[model samples]
Target: MGLHQGPDPYDRQLCQGSLQRPGEDIHPPRPRGSGDRLRHPRRERGSVTLAVVRVRGIINVKNDIRDTLTMLGLGRVNHCVLIDETPQYMGMVRKVRDYVTYGPIDAETAALLLKERGRLEGRKPLDESIIKEMGEFKSFDDMGKAIAEGQLNWS
Candidate 1:
């Protein structure tokens, strides 16, 4: 009765381009907005506020792990740094803008790492020639203009 009932022709292709490529369709836009709803429905809602802390130095890194357990707050580790959400000394922690870890490195080892990094893709060495050429730019605005217009090659 319903036009020789079989699989609905509209379901297969009509819906495909309706939501995506709505411009190609001659039909007026769907009444209740584009038909597709909940594209990524599984994603969770709500914002999570977190305090990030960075641990530096071999000795301090070790100490922070032990101290973080006794400390209040959410604790997580990212790479070599320990981020403690709950800080014991909240006032002192709030003033911290940046944290850095410095490990001892011999000159030869440093030079080897630099050389290896330079050879890697997307890495460039700051050679004297490059530095001298960069010195020609008086300010960051001039450098940005050159880059935006395709005149400068950062790599």
Candidate 2:
């Protein structure tokens, strides 16, 4: 006794590399006009406008940062492109310029400044209570005479 099933027709067709699918273009193609290719046609006899800002950086090697800027719609290095200047775009460019031009602070200078700050904060003298408990004595002579001449006693 055996229980067996034959191969599915769809699977057989796929295995034989004869699988077919429907065409993406279902409608009949229409003839394109002169302006049909453009999504936004350019205006005729109007003023052309552009905004340009200087970008400075060492962009020769390690261009991941540059690539990221381009991905966000900024043009290539050393070349200018017309872009829509919105507040958001302005902010993005400002940040990129800051990063490229002004690099990180040096570690030595940072450490020196930190050490100087600690010294300045920690060099305060002893408080007034300790000074007063020393009996307003300004010199070792005052302390010694008071003890030896019996003017002051500690018994």
Candidate 3:
């Protein structure tokens, strides 16, 4: 008969402590017969080379994830970057996981990626002649092996 409802059912539940209150820790109790302890496995950090490839586009992507992709040097689709397995790099990769795919890469795969997709100044494709001209390594394979083994320092 009145325009205003006397009390809301949701507010009633909150008054009964069904919702979390400010500055208080509220965790639901586990059901009967449930396991008593929380199980968590520890992971060890190992030295490994990770190759991340951008598989998705930037359409409708959030600014934070876009910045992460930019910092990783992946500005376009199908672009890839080789990074060491570290927490900092892993965190950035995780932030953009939906737009990229990453995994451990072997020496042979690294060489192949360099041969097929590597670029240089003026957008020139990487080739054996350039490697010979630069005299950085014997060939792409050697460079790839060094990169995978963490022997090559970019900086």
Show pairs that collide, candidate 3.
Answer: none
lDDT, model 1, position 62: 54
What lDDT tens digits, residue by residue, belong to model 2 across residues 58-77?
Answer: 35634765664665444544
Model 3 score (lDDT): 0.80
CA-only RMSD, every prediction: 19.2, 28.3, 10.6
Evaluate model 2: give its lDDT: 0.41
Candidate 1 structure quality by residue, lDDT tens digits, 57-112: 23444555445432422243332212222233333344332243322233343334
Relative to the true structure, candidate 3 has a C-alpha RMSD (angstroms) of 10.6
Better structure of 2 and 3 per TM-score? 3
How do the residues 40-109 of candidate 3 rate in per-residue lDDT, one tens digit apiece? Answer: 2222343567889999999999999999999999999998888887779989999999999998778999
TM for every model, in the order presented, reads: 0.17, 0.23, 0.62
Worst 10 residues of 2 by lDDT: 43-52
Output the number of the lDDT-best candidate. Answer: 3
Q: So what's the TM-score on candidate 3?
A: 0.62
> Any idea how many clashes model 1 has?
2
Itemize residue pairs with steric clashes in candidate 2.
Answer: none
Off by over 4 Å in 2: 1-50, 57-68, 72-75, 98-155
